[model samples]
Target: MPALEHVQPLEHRSGRTNVPGAHGFLGRLRRRRAQREHEASVICFANALRGMFRDACAGIGLCQYVSVAAGITVRTPRVAEVRLGPPTSFTVELMAGQEPADFTSKDRGPRLAHTLGAHGLRVEPVAGRWVRIHLLDADPLRDGFGLPSLAVATGAESVILGRTEDATTLGHAIADPAHLGVQGQNGSGKSAFCYGLLAQLAAAPDVLVTGSDITGLLLGRAWDGTAHRAHQVVGTQDIAAHAVLLEDLVAEMDRRLETIPPRRDTIRPSPATPIVLVVLEEFPGLLRAADALPKPKRGEGIPVGDRIRTAVLRLLSEGRKAAFRVLMLAQRFEATAVGGGYARDQFALRLSFRVPADSLEMLHGADARPLGQEHANAAPGVAYLSGLGRDCERIRVPYLGEYGEYVDRVQRFGRRAES
Candidate 1:
């Protein structure tokens, strides 16, 4: 959570020399050029220090086993060693924007365990273009303890994943499952964040997992070889298939309801079985299509805009007992987008990302008029997650390259349906 400060040059190897008389004329020009170059180098050095500090903070916050100290060691032009407790596997990592090819330096220590550093982390650059640095961990750096794949800590009823500077962003207890809702804009990392949640849920022994998406890409290859055996990527263009799938789900919901015992009115899903997560990407498409019908169910006195509203309300009222949870994604928020009080209350957690100026009223509240005007079009993967007591806070979700690997491995086991 520490911020970068101005770094003064500890030493400068290059300097301009003033010549007298004969070379004086040409010397002035040379001196000017040399001064510029020196200044540029000094800037690079200082900027590198800030980057190293940021990376060290990120590592300490992110890693389960690694604890980085405030100390930083600059070995050369682009090489830095961060002291985070005793060296273990990867005590030192190549900071982002620093390439091994930039300045060549070699060091010996423990055997290298991991060569490919965390990739896809976006960082701003003060000089040149933004770059991603690779993290390396070798034998010399290994501490006696092995790091856990994920280290989650729940304190003060708040959840802290990795390291975060913002206090209210992630440390709150997860609200009731039924009250969770998330909203985000395009490329805001909402999809990726959802994937991470799915992974975490899958790892839990008591939960079942089932998910479907209208767009074939949102779920993508993330669920390739995990515990999920049945996956549905419903295409919006195919209305017939889509309707059939919905009918089946309705029947499934009814079936689950019937299983509730008379004495014990509570409906419980078997822990071994996977629960269904109906992930609708841009669900408005389905609502619009349903409303196109001549005599669709509009609920009692509900207008035509009530199609989605009714559906959402139905899910909220009855879906929970059936072990069906809705994870809906939309690009925008509009009154006509989702119908009635049902749509309004169906999603308890709403997340917003780079939303349109006009949609703020529907997404955030009428009072968000000010924010809507100064809307910060957050970068891809950045979002504001609200709901379950985790109010809207700016966040950047990290992508675990493991998805690609999962896809490759699953495809090897069996061919994926191309169509």
Candidate 2:
């Protein structure tokens, strides 16, 4: 990989790097200033944490007598460096057998943050008894870092979706045909995330993104490819037409599956045989449309509305091995919205953003409930990543700086399918 621009060059500062390359004396001065400030923040944060523990530890029944040195271990890097995403944080290693949930209990995050005299500090567990505390000084999710150019991501195997929050971390979703769901309320950056993910997928040579939306608010300009080459876009203009489109997409997916060599483990997308990612936007719109249909008659086939939903559920279940996947976006997610009591369970990955805590029910094994009105309602893109057998992670979608340009760029790369 190419060297990151944020990397401090050695030709300049002998002592340390301050931004990129301020030479010699000036670089050192800037470096020292940054280092001093970082060190001071670390000191203040540690002191405040220690004080908080003094009062809460004994009350919480923690084993104060368990180890030779029983206080929390503050593990923060001494190298004061600037990072591009979320603010860097420190971890507090508790005594053996003491897990993170012990101290990171509900409401304790705000309390500890207040004690340290900061807001927007994200506190969560990293491992057994190790609590990672992100002491954020600013809102990292407010803007975008430059995204991967179309040339860079096009034809590559996987797609970059977003970064994990406090999770100043980068994460990718493999096109090895993955099914992903995102649930969040308005102002939760839902549309922003779809664009970010779609832009990269659009760049990929082997991937084509087709989506359906009601308001067209999210997929508006982006899905407008040339008629001959445009990946289909399903509009809410006609509900019945939309339902039929869902069935058509499912049939298309089935054809892809049939072409896969039997017993093969996975289907890989390539330019010649591109894989399809069918995105369902503002999914509730589809649900409402589907739900409007009358129930099926006793001896007949599935109801028209029922078929649309069942098609989605089946697509998610059977499409993975066929190099086909679905990205479902919703303002609300729960059993009722998802077709059946067990249908929601089929989604391979689920992300929940700022909403009433109850919305977390959509994500299985979800522990961190949305902190409503907490931390000023968590940043717009801030959310939690959940899946079966995985620890939940807080994540944020990167901004797609220029929406129109991104759409145009995708159009340049994506063509209508022959399949």
Candidate 3:
């Protein structure tokens, strides 16, 4: 009747239906099988990852995390990446009686990525989207808890550094003259951390502090000899002095190391602990100087540059045991700004404050994309840390004004002086 339908011509040799029931069923079966295969692959990869991780834990005293490079392959919906897709708690469960436990599910991924990258495989592909990361080598330093380490208060003794929510120092005391590292972009809390450190250390008994900032003005007020005698020289020094300063610091580090105290429990507060802390504001200054001249020309006429380089190398190689900690302060902590590789690696501890989207890598480690996701535009005094522990953590430092006042009153004169 609808000859009208003008079903014109079913132009097909085989009269075909728009929805082929049999073909659709066959396609569905194929998809289901593919999915099953993908799932199986993921399980196999995950197990492989678990085994690799166990091996890493055994080799390295510390626990480690593995990231499967899922992008290398395709994964079915049934297979999910066993990673912190968001800012999540990361943890790793270790094998039985491993002495040190492995990463629990509560640790974050970026931190895991940094630690593993140092001694593990990267961008490994698994079945579909899965990957099995094999982390090798281990850290020798054990945390106070004998597991994953915590960020202890890196402040001079008696300075009253506040504890972050994730870490509590109710009874814990930091080493005096704590080497501090502050990193952030322009307007980040680099200056703030510097100010806080100076003031806090000043409060400690008989503590001496000094620092230099190339791109800041706040240090002028807090460290101005005319106003504050905290011993900070503000404004950029001529390249000559800048070069010599590093050499002097190296000498200082050597001297300090010679003074390291034996691990003692006298509870009498050993005087061997250094009370002076030096903060280098804007660490790029040294890196820039070093890279400008070739090794031969570095100290050719002036020995200053060569000496500085040697000093830094020695400090990095031996400062930790000597107790001569260096505090590197910068607006950002990128490999380039910090002189990359050797120079950048010298500073083991790095603290990034509020920074721009592109600079998280400087503050954290190279694999900071995940941290960028969470703290791209975070406020000053807030930062994410890795290498400091088994997982990356977001931290908020307390703000401090009147650094000199804090030093004079709370630190030196006691709380009564503040009133």
Candidate 4:
């Protein structure tokens, strides 16, 4: 893939003049304070947006979509305001419903922005009877994105995967039991997302990392026992080797669930006990290998592939509360590879980094078959973040350096911290 120099800001906003001679000290200071307040306040709809949104919002059924607000205007929705953003992007607030979700539901939302002549869009709740509509002029990921230092990337909330197409908001990865599902065709930068994620993850204290690939190539090169790395990584095509690791994972899941306090939903990382992240590379191939083996019977030894599947399935079903999160990588998202719907649901966050039509459909939905073509051809790490429900938007995973370079940096950062 191509590397991008850090993300260049298109611009914050337009039409601000710096009066060098300004109104004297206090006057100038008051003007600056006003500027700051203006920046912080929500924007008003632009002139051009008035007509576009009026038509688009009505088309999306926002006017007709209303909630139980007793005689609420369910027939003729109005776009109350369009917050002016940068020249290319902005947000709109509609007279929606008591619950924004009612107006921005899957039935009404999925393709509203796409139909509104936007590169991407997101619908969010903004207090009562109001849902915010954000529109982007073009796909932000097409330009490619770069990662910050490990120190910056490790911060749970600020470490950006990439911003929305509009550049209005930054999306970051959450470590709180959001087991991720990453899918894309070969050479589509699926691994880029994984390794990039691992790089940021390594910075968090008490976060245990482990990864595996059938050929022992990618993870082997990136996470081998180095001066600064301490996680266990499995790199082999052998099913038996994978089986052993999976068995241990299942065992740990069982042990932890039994040991953790009853009320907690999942484990939180701390200085002592850490969050465990397991990455499965070429996961579908391994899954198929497991499914091919005959079912294990009483008094008969199970095949390594089957054993591996059992452990993986267990992790998917019951690992969250146990603090075991898995990032499954595969070229396909077929039933045989990713298990049935029940299993797939365990992955709260699903990402499709540059994938083909068939895989894209399976990962997102049938309608998404054509969605990721931009990432597959023009941009590498660009993908649709499917977990955002009806508001699923296109985002680019920031490309950290190649595996070795990233690991080296992680080590160097560790040394600096120690000193």
Candidate that would win on TM-score: 2
User: Across residues 1-419, which tens digit of lDDT does each residue of candidate 4 receive?
Assistant: 01212322123133334534433566446556766677555443355556665566577665674567575543444466555654243334444343455433444544665666665555666665565666656554567667766543332444455566556545555555577888777777778776666666665665566655674544554454442233444544455667777778778778777777677756555545556677788887776665675666877787656677677788888887777778888776676677666667677778876666666667677656545554456467777786644356677777875766676755544322232
Name model 1 segments beyond 4 Å from true.
1-175, 203-208, 220-233, 261-265, 272-274, 288-312, 339-341, 366-370, 401-419
lDDT of each structure? 0.46, 0.62, 0.47, 0.62
Model 2 residue runs over 4 Å out of place are 1-50, 59-94, 99-111, 120-148, 151-156, 217-221, 226-231, 293-302, 364-366, 370-376, 388-390, 402-405, 412-419
Is candidate 2 or 3 superior in lDDT? 2
Off by over 4 Å in 3: 1-179, 215-221, 224-232, 256-276, 286-307, 356-358, 361-368, 387-390, 402-419
lDDT tens digits, residue span 298-363, model 2:
988766667778777777788777676778888777777766656667677888777666676446
TM-score of 2: 0.69
Weakest lDDT window of 10 consecutive positions for candidate 1: 104-113
RMSD of each: 16.9, 9.7, 16.1, 11.5
For each candidate in turn, the TM-score is 0.50, 0.69, 0.50, 0.65
List pairs with backbone clashes in candidate 4: 43-83, 45-82, 63-77
Local accuracy of candidate 3 as per-residue lDDT tens digits, 296-408: 65444744445555555565556555444567766666656654457666654556666765777655655665557546676666665544343444555545554454334
Scored against the true structure, residue 117 in model 2 reaches a CA lDDT of 51
Candidate 1 matches the true fold with a TM-score of 0.50
